[model samples]
Target chain A: MTARFAVGDRVRVDDRTPPGHIRTPWYIRGKSGVVADMVGAFADPEDSARGGDGLPERPLYRVRFRQTVAWPDYAGDGRDTVDIEIFEHWLEPESG
Target chain B: MSTNVDDHDHDHARTFVPDEEDSLGQYAIVEMAVRELLIEKGVFSADEFRQGLEVFDKAGPHLGARAVARAWTDPAYKESLLSDGSAAVKEFGVDMNLTELYVVENTPRVHNVIVCTLCSCYPKPLLGAPPDWYKSRNYRSRMVREPRAVLAEFGTTLPDGVEVRVHDSTATMRYMVLPMRPEGTADLTREQLEALVNRDAMIGVTVVPAP
Candidate 1:
């Protein structure tokens, strides 16, 4: 599947709290970050976690979020960042 | 009282060996049951499962150390490792088991650390099993929240100017830190350099000490 986001694209993680197996970390939920890299396509992990064949792969990206943005009281250099792996479906394009 | 083996009574429980299955808890029993069901169903042979276990047992952190040492010595190879870590490790015959690898480099400007906040998803093939501390809920939760403080607890005090980048392994990607080569290691061979690297350094908790 084609990746909806590209490197440097600002995207916000979908802030849904659906019940069941989820890979996205809670601290990262509802946060916005820039796509760092497209780490190839892979089967949807939520599908695989439930014993179903994770076919129709989805694109995954490495997203970079500034620590200051993620945490209000972040106690590190302004340049500090957190990189997380997020699936295409968990992300939405951020508009200025 | 100093007891001697020669004068000891030979009254030990000989036939009361503890069976592995009997000692297992509910989860282990379920795992054994599932394995037996799969084997009974001819999904895979017992020998295949045994061989897979043997292969996993042989994996160790030395594999990752060697890879890091190679990267320290060879710039071109280091570039490949930083770009496509899974493929680069494959060149040295390390199997990633279909998981993608991200090799983050530690430089003067940046210090990198890895954690699986969701669960303990580590690079077992390259760096052996996850250490107990890495699997702790405290480390998983705190590392992302206050990385610099957690790092200081490990005796790693990064300068204020150096940015601390934390890589949360929340998805399929596995992370390994490529520690900066120590100042005095220029003359050391790759094999010698490998000796300086340990599991903690690769996890980004510490730096490779100058030898």
Candidate 2:
């Protein structure tokens, strides 16, 4: 599945947690960010491990999250941002 | 290239261990299969794998310490470090040709920490393989969000008035913390100073010169 979010689009990572192995680091799971760039599609290793071969490759997105949103009291320069590369399966569209 | 059939089988048989399917058995199985297949196809000789494993085995904990020591002693280098980290590393005689080296500095106001949210992107050339805890989801998730909290859990508690900055490692890049050296070690030699910078200090969970 191709991720809907693209570079410069404001989005929030869904907070839902699922059982089993995941690649999304726990630190940025529920944090929001703007999509930076899309890494080419690749096999979802987590899904492929679960007998999901023939599974279509999914596009990966590089999401850039502001440091403040990830940390409540982050007292840095306030312009600090971190870019995270997440698989398509890990993200969903943010609702207004 | 000695392509003797008997020698080829002998080399494979020596490296292949039974799959216990427990602990690191899966990794071992995969490693053995890949190595054996590659060797059989002459992608790389058995000697290459042997030499690689030897080099890895020879790696010690002192590599990271040596880098830290050089940074502490050189002021111009430190400035270069703060400006362009990877380039400054070249001044120390450390070759980071294979991987990207990220230098995170620790200041009085803010402490720089590093975590690989995905897998361990360790500076194998300098710091060697990462500790198992580094790959744990618990470390990746809690460290960035609640750095102080996570540090405390790891038996590291900073005093009041210090800020924590966590750098999440993604892609092929690796990170190392340039910790603030403790006082009273001024008279020590470079080797002595190197001993003070621990792996935990580089990880930013603990301060240097563990006293």
Against the true structure, what is each candidate's TM-score?
A: 0.90, 0.64
Q: What local lDDT score does residue B85 receive in model 1, on the 0 to 100 scale?
A: 93
Docking class of 2: incorrect
| RMSD from true fold, candidate 2 | 9.5
Model 2 clashing residue pairs (backbone): A27-B141
Instruction: List, residue by residue over B35-139, the lDDT tens digit for candidate 1.
Output: 999999999999999988987887788989988999988999899999999989887677888787789999999999999988898988888899999999999
Model 1 RMSD vs true structure: 3.2
Candidate 2 Cα outliers beyond 4 Å, as residue runs: A1-68, A71-96, B1-27, B83-98
Worst window of 10 by summed lDDT in candidate 2 chain B: B91-100
For each model, chain A TM-score?
A: 0.95, 0.83
The residue-level lDDT of candidate 2 at A18 comes to 81
Question: What are the lDDT figures for the candidates, one per model?
Answer: 0.89, 0.72
Best by lDDT: 1
Task: State residue B67's C-alpha deviation in candidate 2, in Å.
Answer: 1.3
lDDT of 2 by residue, B61-111 (tens): 577777678778988776776555567666655566645566768878777
